[model samples]
Target chain A: MIAPLLHVTGLSKRFGGFVALNDVSLQVAPGERLGLIGPNGSGKSTLVNCMSGTLVNDRGRVQFDGRVLDGLPPHRRAYLGLARSFQLPRPFSSLSVRDNMRIPLLYTAAVRAGRQRAENEIRERTEELLRVVGLIDKADARPIDLTQVDMRKLELARAMAADPKLLIADEAMAGLSNAEVDDILGLLMRLNAQGISIILIEHIMKAVMAFSQRLVVLVSGNKIADGAPSEVIRNDHVVRAYLGQ
Target chain B: MTSATAVENPGRKVQAQIGTPMFAALATGVAVLFYVALALIGNEYLYFSGYVVLQFVVMATAWNILGGYCGYVNFGSAAFFAMGAYSTVCIYSIGTEYARSGVGKILGAIPPPVLVPLLIAFAGIIAGLVGLGMGYLTLRLRGVFFSIATLALSVVLQTLVVNWDFVGGSRGAYVIRPNEFPLLPGGFIAYLFVLMLLLVVVALTLARGIERSRLGFGFTAIRDDELAAEAAGVPTLRLKLIATTVSGALMGMAGASFPYYIGYLQPNSAFGLEYAVNAIAMPMVGGTQSWVGPLVGALLLGSFQQWATVTISSVLNLLIVGLVLIFFVIVAPNGIVGLVREWRRKRVLRKAVRP
Candidate 1:
């Protein structure tokens, strides 16, 4: 019942008259872990993009930490402690692993927080982020040299570099092994425990169920359910429209 | 395996690979030889041809900024170059007239030698500004559409220049007689070889700097995939504009020296498809993966073009470029130098593995 750290009211986005997200609304409390589940093409990414300021919504507003995020660009949003890890890990392939970690902190976190971390400080922080993602071994390696799991880890680590209050992880666990899913799930939980809110968008139900404190489902751009993970998973409409399928 | 491990830095390695002591000596030797030839020959034809090739190298290396590293194919390179060339001419033209009036003696007292870098800087800035404008207009389009839009912009700019008589549109404007410096390839050609040399250094340095920086990482990612880059906090539109603008400006600076070098400024020649082709070719021939490829491609192909035109003709130069381009695409899509380096690396790996 406490005030939500993030609030979305009457959110709507349309692509050339095709509604990608229609009247979608959800909220998350500070440091709460949330899972956003949906069928294929069910506005998950559109919603993420809208909130992250990658795309501007036509109607409604997203309020993060009490600031209206209607016109802010993604970097500015990141400066306000918003971060996102892509579905397909998109690290800077040409740069070394350490430099990839250096970007967000150098460009956003250090600048915004007015915490003038020195070169060695940034380097140490980059090393720490890489270590958390189990990628310290490939610290000097290029993204092109990384395997799929490593790329995903780099992507998550990159988002984490922003020192964000909320991390929108879109399909972070997709196309991973069973063990890899658990590994990512554990990371997300650890991140949540560190007072970082997460909106996990994934197809893997087990990881979602295991990680999410609150669950939300989207069916054809509409928010169908937003409540306790157990209650939302057992909802009849969700099963009929999404889960059973 | 150490060398087999993919290089964390892309363009730097290309530069490092080419920056060997022997290669640098050879390149430096060739450049000195060309300058010597131009200085001693005093032949108008040879100097003019040398000037043309030098200009082409400048343009090609400049164009590589966007087309090669950022993966945005800019066909409207001439717009900025022509703008650049014209700006310098206008500024020089105005300065000479101002010098003639009551202000002449007072201005003459100042160190006139400062004009060279001033003009070069002004030319680069003007072109960069033009590039900024064009980037804003055409950066939204990608692939062939982007190329076409930029080309169309060049055409529009060409027409605009053709109408503006102050910039010496179709009639061609001539600046006051330049100082008769004895630096081989008299007048503008000498100035241009020096300009070309400076540009090569600038392009190489800028390319290497960006390729190793955070901006460079963001750029390659955007080139790889836009949506994915955006999701990862790489600002796409802003980066593309900066790339295209800087790319445009460098070409513009290259263009800025053209009026003095050619001694005649015309819209058609300044804003031609030849510039477009040369720009695209340099990066491709050089191996767009690294900045060195463009310089290497420029030196090799540029020297070959110079030799061909002298031994054969200008048409033959085009034929060589066309053939070489086709050959590179088929035999080695990464370009000649890249292919050679790859071959050498594989050979080394194989040799080391022998038990």
Candidate 2:
């Protein structure tokens, strides 16, 4: 079998006396779409933070693309093609939307390519990403000026600018209209089609079911289910802990 | 292909902008003209006051590197400035000791022209290392906590200086100025002014260069949101350390000539509260967003303080600074550059709507 692109072995995290994630281990195959679902305060964001190097797991190791990622900082993880969007959109408020997009291109993508991208090239790529997210018109607008939906789009687009091998999108579709939900789902689907592995963490079950071939559920910091989405959602523990059926 | 063409068309229309080298050249020309104009005035008092004002320009610009660009407030500007001043004192004291012992004449033999530059370089390195050390210890604490830590750092450094007797400790050390400068047209004061003028040029050029570089973008990103910046692949801690080192080094270079400027270096004067206060106030009053902000702020505020000292009383100088700072904070929080930018933005918007 092919080695997993991302490997987490017996991962654990705690905050003071409270356990946030308890010995959780997971894997994502190359180019796979995995949905991560958890009830509120079930360690979904905490797990993402640990995986992205924003938070250090108390135990276990995270290996990504054949390198151990135990003590690397978030920027180093980003350099190694691991990227995530904050659950709540955290845009660089002072920068114009275009400049915001240009940041990752300047720092991550260009560094990965081992050369400074030409100014014209950076501009072209920024506009292209902005166009993909349907935010070209608001390219020069500050983050404060963007509507909620556009802000979310900007968050995802900024993550995309890193050109990551795996994109863990944390609640990228929250608080959007059905049409807007479909808009983001379509974008994610297009990205997956380009062979970028994605972990879609969302509460929108319908979108998750449609987008994810496999599913992982975290309940009170414990992974109770991980399997095909059709079978995992119907699991007794998942239904009792999360689905409430 | 058509859409690509469309995008390329507008991108190509951007006017050619002035690069850093051109900006540096223009600034150097302007600085020379200012120096010549001051010399033509033929007033030694102007050079003396001008030196103080230019010193503020350097300090304000240095403070803005960490405080304004990176959003890390440094309340210990005086500590770094004093470090530079005291480094010179230590060297002078050691040279006097060496001269008395008849061990070597190398330190005493170095002329002022060569000696001042050497002292400036030495002070910059020493203060930069301290800044790095301080940043490593304190940069993890963000917001007001980081600022308070810097204030504490100032007090600790001042205590160390007060107790170190080799450089005269609490009493102070006397640095007798030579009657004349070797190559310079003016006296020692004039020589000091010219050195400060060159330092201003270097500081401004360096600040402007950083503002336009990729590093500048990273700094602004960290300033805006450090976590987000890190996630965007910026090494936030590394960048902050760089800012601290550069800022501290520049402030140190500004203070290296202080002993010569005053001819008497006292702990109270070297670690004065005025240095810290003026460093912060000048940037805030001028606008902290760009290099121009600190330069303008320093010149305006420094000149006013000089004028007030001469025309009015020196005691009221701090009071005037305090009042002006309060007025700007209330009326124009972004400072003069920000105000100008806001005005110009409104003008452009009006024109666009009219057409």
Candidate 3:
């Protein structure tokens, strides 16, 4: 489909004889908001790990921007404009909010620039990223001082610091009030509108409905459906098994 | 650039650094002179206290590389110190024999005073290589697992040396002090304090650079959450290895100088739990989150233990360390530096409000 931005073919994985993913094939176009939804133990996280190069897939072709990514590490993938936020937000607790964002921004951005960006440039950009995530007021605060929502915002901000073209926000809005969830949903939408492709894996139906332009449903690590959000929700097995319709 | 701007106006912010460069410089100069004056006073009590305090500074600063910034507590630091001390012993003993050999005759032109630097460099290099090797293995494991593996390696190394008679086994080995000639009887107390001073500076520079650099933040990320660090694009494995290796090398340097200070080296002294505990306690009482924490911990707690050991007793020194550590953990978890920082911020805010 219009020369896939991220292409996966024959992706297979196992955890000591128990198959986690089996011959999964998928394609992601550039600047697409793709929602990957599934029930518990559906290997969503594992698939994400494989795609992000945290756990190497046993057999697969993970092609991003015409280059094969088989043995590259997660940081390398991040350097290549692929970033992800953890299901549980992880900010370096020892660093201030600004310093935490500065980590990826300095490393990846400097490398991409092919020369050391001045210290001032790094600081300015880090503050700008923090501002974008609405964490400027708490820039000097430690992660421990942050509420859960702020922690998640920091996580997203850290991912954004890499200036990724593709982002996988894994359960970013989990365990938030409806209003909080909507708040994060708006942030994700704003990021999406800025020409970044976002793959959101979440359980919140309201968010899944609101954010996704295309949806992929997984049941027990197998793709159950892949189509528009409206039509995919109409599938019989998806409704009875996953959608609870 | 923004850090400069941020510093230009602290703006009622608690995390503001007040004249950071000047503050740190004044602190370092004062600390160095304090130890130097104590050494010059030359009371046996001051000398004895001087010795313990200097070593504690080294051990704590060494351990901070891995434990404080990276958040990986290395219970195995004794191994690095032991390696350095034993290397010094081995080199001294072997050099003595060589002093009698055909090679020794040709080398007689080089004064024995120069040998101290030679032996130190050798021991540091050996320890650093060993550290690099140890890091390759232990750095793969994270958190508790990494600590356990390193702790086990420490035991393994101590056992290995205990059985090896070359550097004196469990019975231990003794070395003549540096510049032992009466004409050049080195003021070892002064030397040690100087060494500690320089090391603290080095460690501070390293810690500060890393704290502000990407690696510094990466270390914090790994400490905060390893999974998140990886997701956040930190090369976690590389960062941990670097921290461990640096930690090990510093421990080695400490060990190398130890033999002359104590006049004897034994496996227990070399690989004892006390050394590891002292290392941890120094940073713990200082506030590991910032570079200043370990420096403060090493200076304050380290000196107190030394003075206590001489004025009170050796066993009493351990008690003081234990009490202080417990007090810090239970009360000010952020340690003395954090407390001082809090106090300073409040004071600064009050000054700003004055009409």
Candidate 4:
């Protein structure tokens, strides 16, 4: 098998006495699509937070693209081609949507290119990303003016601006119509097709089943199952703990 | 894809871009015009009051670099200002001591024209280092916590200044003002006014330049949501530290001429609460979002305070600020700049719909 793009080992996080994630280890191969799902009060977000450097893990290590991401800040991780969208859309409200896209491009993509990107190049790239997310018309609009789904789209597009090798979308579709979920799923599929690995964390089963090649289940700070999507769903432990068989 | 073709560079069409150098030239032209007007008026009282107003322009602009751009409210304006004032005092005291000594007469002979600019630069460097140090210590605390720490910092610095005796301490220090300036017609007060006018030009140009650059975008991102900014690859801490240092340096430069202007430098006067309040209020009252806001706010409010001090009572200045601030908070929550933006946006919408 090819080497994994992301590897988390024995990751543990605690808030006071309560363990948020404990001994959680996982791997995603290059160009793989992995689904991370868990019940309420489970460690899914805690794990993402640790991996993204929003919150430090009490113990264990996170490796991404052949580099150890132990104490690196989130911006440093983005420099290394790891990017995540917040569970809630947190666009720079004061900025227009296109300007929002410019943040990651200016900071991460430009730095990665190792040369200054011309203003026209940055503007064109921004427009292209906004178009991909179907937000081209709303480029001049403020984030506050966008609909819920469009806000999510803007969030994803902003993350995509970094040209990340690995994208961890934390619940990119939470409260969406069936149509909106499919729209996001299609966007994610398009991004994945461009040689970008994706770890999709979602509660929506239909989208997850349709999107993830592999599935990982978390329950009460522990990974209960990790395997092919179909087999993982059929696992007795996952069914009992999460699928509610 | 068809819609992409339809849009056809919508962002470019909307943006009326001005290069930084062009903007700076225009701003300097406007400032030079104002300086000429003031010099032609040739009133020393006008220069004195104008110097106070222009000084606020620098302080308010400085405060906005961190407070308005990055959403970090620094309540230690007076502390930084006093740091600059005391730095000037230190230099002045040293010069006086050297003049009194037989062997060191040559060192004391350094002329005011050369000496004043050096003192301003020195004060800026000293205050900038202090700002960097303070930001490193306190930037981790967000929102109100950061503000509280800044307030505490001012108090601590004030106590330190009151106790330290070398630069006159609680007893205060005197800086003998030169009666004449060689180059200009209106003497030393006019020289101070001209220096402050140039400083305003520098501060405004710097503020406007930052507002349009990548650094400005990072600052706006931090102001909007710091967590998202960091995740988006913007270095929030470094950007914030830069803001603090720049902000502190400008405030220090504003104060560098204070001892010379006032002829007396007391800890209480230099570390006046008025400096801190006016610095914050000017930005908030004018609008914190753009470079234009602080300048507008400082000029309007600073001029009014000066007028009130002359026509009514000096004691009423703070009371007027409080009243005006409350009125603006209720009536124009986004400040004057925001109000203008909202109006302009509506007008555009109206025009678009008319066709």
Candidate 5:
């Protein structure tokens, strides 16, 4: 197979004596949809944080798009086209919806493109992203005005504004309705079709099974299974560790 | 795609909101008009009072850039202000020694008006460098810890000044202003007022520039949620450094002129708690959110303080600030600008419902 877009090898994280992520390794190919699922406290979020450079692993290496991200901070990682959305929508409350997108677009995408985008070009891109997420009419509104599902969509759009090579979406549809989950799933599929690799970390099994081409299961900071969604879900170990409930 | 085309260029529109050239012209005109009115009135008290208020305008504007925009509360503003005030002391001693040794021809030859701007710029640079150092050292602490470090910094600076005898130790040093007048007929105080008016214009321009620029966007992101801002690709540390340096520099510029205005400088008055408290309170009262907030807060609260100093006791000046600060914090957490925005928002909502 071709070189993976993201490669986390022998990653381990410790919170005092408790191992949050222990020797966990995973990979995602270009244009691939990978689902990362685990029980609560199973280190799914910890793994995402390590890969996104929010939390540095105690011992391991995160290689994204050919660069070792050991010493790189989150913004530097983002500049290299690694984008993430928080489990909670963390929009700049002082800024309008459009400026929220502009921060990532201006800093990450423009820096990666190595050119100064025209003022109009940024506006067009921001509006287009808003339109895609069904937030075009609320472009001028603040994040405080957004509904829960809209805030999640804004989070995704903000990440998409980075025009990343790989997107690590941490629980993008955690509390959404089934219809809203479908909305985000369709959006993620469209993003994948446009050639961006994505790691969807979700608790909802149906959404996970519907979207992931490959599924990786973690049990207590360790990867229990990694393969095709159907095969991984049916695995005896994954069933015992996670799916038995 | 068609909807995207229909949307106006938001970036260009936001830039247009600031009206850069128009703002410059209007601000310049207003400053000139203000000084002209003071000159025509020919009242020394008016100029003196106006100078103090204008100084607060600069201080408040500077403080808000870091405290309001970047969400870094600096409780050591007096340290930077004192640094600027002490810069003049340093220059004075150097010039004095040169003249005493009969080798100060170059220093004495430059007119005081020309020298004042040079001194202000030098003071600003010194304060800015200190700000950069303090930010590098303490900004990593986060929230109240950072503020505590700043307060400790003030005490450290004050102790150093108290011990240093060159600037008169704890006794205070006298700054002798030249009797000659070059730019204005009203001599030293009037000249200082004009210099301060210029500083006000500089401070306003800078604060507004940051408010509308990409830097402001990064600052707000840091303020909102620093972790998310980092993930959003904002270099938070670098932007915070810029804000602190600029804020400290302007406060220092105001302080550099303090000795000439007061004719005497001491550690207590220069590094007093009043400067720090007033600088912060003005922005909090007017609104910490934008450039206009600090201006309004300074003019209103500063003039009120000046009036109280003349009418009531000097001790009551801080009392007024404490009351106003408490009122704003409890009633309108967003300050005066917030109140105005809330009022406007309600009016719009009411109108929409009526239709």
Candidate 6:
């Protein structure tokens, strides 16, 4: 009965001659864990970019929280409660991990709160977020000092600092050990439990299967399947294109 | 997110250490230093040379705001500086003509205190707008392309100034120094030196304020990774424009007093290569990140250049600057401030290990 929190209709993107996303339509209800999986160059990140306003779609529209997001910048989208983590963990190298968390909190969440939050409150929130992500010990350390998994956690924490209604985490668990993957999966699940809707684009099938309640499959810029995770995984085309018979 | 106790943290400690009181104390200390220097220096030549060195401090500090903090390199420092210098010429001509008209004789009597600052403010605004225009045109071009555009902008501005007969053609224009100050103790040169000293303080304070503010955080975010900053809700284009305008305006403010100092300003002298190179090199040699780096760098390099000009040939001043800059870039790319921080960090590590 409720309208979808995020609704994408006929979304298409092109990079000159190559079509990256073609008429990809999808929807996510509030607080839903949506999995988006595609093989390399299958427009998984492209769709995330379009929805996040990093890249503008040539066709179709993205509707978030009942507003049509036609031509907004990434920061504007962030202000409207949309957030994303980069594939390569682009932490502010010069800043401490604490500062990294505080910046996004200040610019997005605090600005969205209309600067009503006190400095103490912001600092407390920053620390709380850091602690939740297990980066409390390394709060004063720079991004360069962080390990691969910590960098990923920091990236996710920075996204969390935005206090987004919808978070599209692009490949957050890539290149991590199985245990590290579980660590991130737990973090994402905790965030989801706190009522933040998430669209996770991941190559790690274990994480995708463990985290995604609803699954969507893309292949060469086309949406192949959209249904329950078990049903989508069992679909003939999805297995042929992605899961490999 | 889980509830956490309000514990003593390094982030809070660092923030507390550098709040309003610290900056206020720094300002007072600098003011006292200048006061003592003013009373001690009786030589006219020392005051004259001191003015130029302080001017560089202002320029370097301003340049670093955009170049160092925001990672936007500007090769058109001369253009902004010249805009200020030329603004002064235009204002001087207009004010002098107005004074000669008998009704404005009263206005001419109040020249030094009233007119100079007004003209300087006007110069700053004009240069700021120009900087905004330049940013609009070229800021979309990343790194080397943006720098090249600024280089081209300097040449274009120089050509326009050379042909503009109103202010001064290629020949030159003379700015007559005012005879006296009503409220101030310093005569003309002394007053100019004092004005420049005040300008240095203002520029440093402004730079420091920006370095500490939300805007400063936004700037570094853009500097580090623009896409990431944008996704984090920093408006990159707007921040870049602000940085460019503020940086350009302060450099223009420093240049506004140039005509009076030089007395005779030609196109080559006003839009010289030295202005562009020194503006960049000082900040680079000092460390681009913080306001202190540029201040320390400008003072060291500026005084050294002054000393070099006096001892060696004037031509060798630039050569020495070139050598120092090249050496610093290769050996200490982060500058003197970075070097000091590294040294201090090593000392702390050694102490920690032993203790």
Which residue pairs come into collision in candidate 5? none
The residue-by-residue lDDT of candidate 5 on B1-355, one tens digit each, is: 3233223222323334535445666798899999999899898888789999999999999999999999989888889899999998878766775774553556556677887889899999999999999999998899999999999999999899899888888999988887657668677888899999999988898787777667777888899999989998998889999998999999999999898888889999999878899888999999998898999999999999999998998998898899999999999989998899789989999999997
| Candidate 6 residue lDDT tens string, B174-216 | 8888767555445677777887888887888778777776788
lDDT, model 4, position B111: 81
Q: Is candidate 3 or candidate 4 better by DockQ?
A: 4
- Where does candidate 2 clash, by residue pair? none
DockQ of 3: 0.56
Classified by CAPRI criteria, candidate 3 counts as medium
| Local lDDT at A95 for model 5 | 85
* Candidates sorted by TM-score, best first: 2, 4, 5, 6, 3, 1
| lDDT of the candidates, in the order given | 0.77, 0.91, 0.78, 0.91, 0.88, 0.87
Candidate 1, residues A186-236: lDDT per residue as tens digits? 888889889999999999999899888899999889999999999998899
**What fraction of the real A-B contacts shows up in model 5?**
0.82
Report the lDDT tens digits of candidate 5 across residue range A62-146.
Answer: 9988889998989999999899999988988888898898888767887888975666788889999999989999998999999
Docking class of 5: medium
- State residue B302's C-alpha deviation in candidate 5, in Å: 0.4
Instruction: Between candidates 1 and 2, name the one with more favorable lDDT.
Output: 2
| lDDT, residue A135, candidate 3 | 89
| Candidate 4 CAPRI level | medium
How much of the true A–B contact set does each candidate keep? Answer: 0.26, 0.67, 0.65, 0.89, 0.82, 0.67
Alpha-carbon runs more than 4 Å astray in model 6? A243-245, B1-29, B96-110, B179-186
Worst 10 residues of 1 chain B by lDDT: B1-10
Model 2 lDDT per residue over A112-164, tens place: 78876767788889999999989999998989999888999999999999999
How do the residues A1-245 of candidate 4 rate in per-residue lDDT, one tens digit apiece? 88899999999999999999999999999899999998988989999999999999999999998999998999999998988999999989988897888888879887877765666788889888988999999998989999999999999998999989999999999999999999999999999999999999999999999999999999999999998999998888988996466
Off by over 4 Å in 2: A243-245, B1-16, B100-104
Q: Note the chain A TM-score of all models in turn.
A: 0.97, 0.98, 0.96, 0.98, 0.98, 0.97
Model 3 stretches astray by more than 4 angstroms: A243-245, B1-32, B39-45, B100-110, B178-189, B343-355
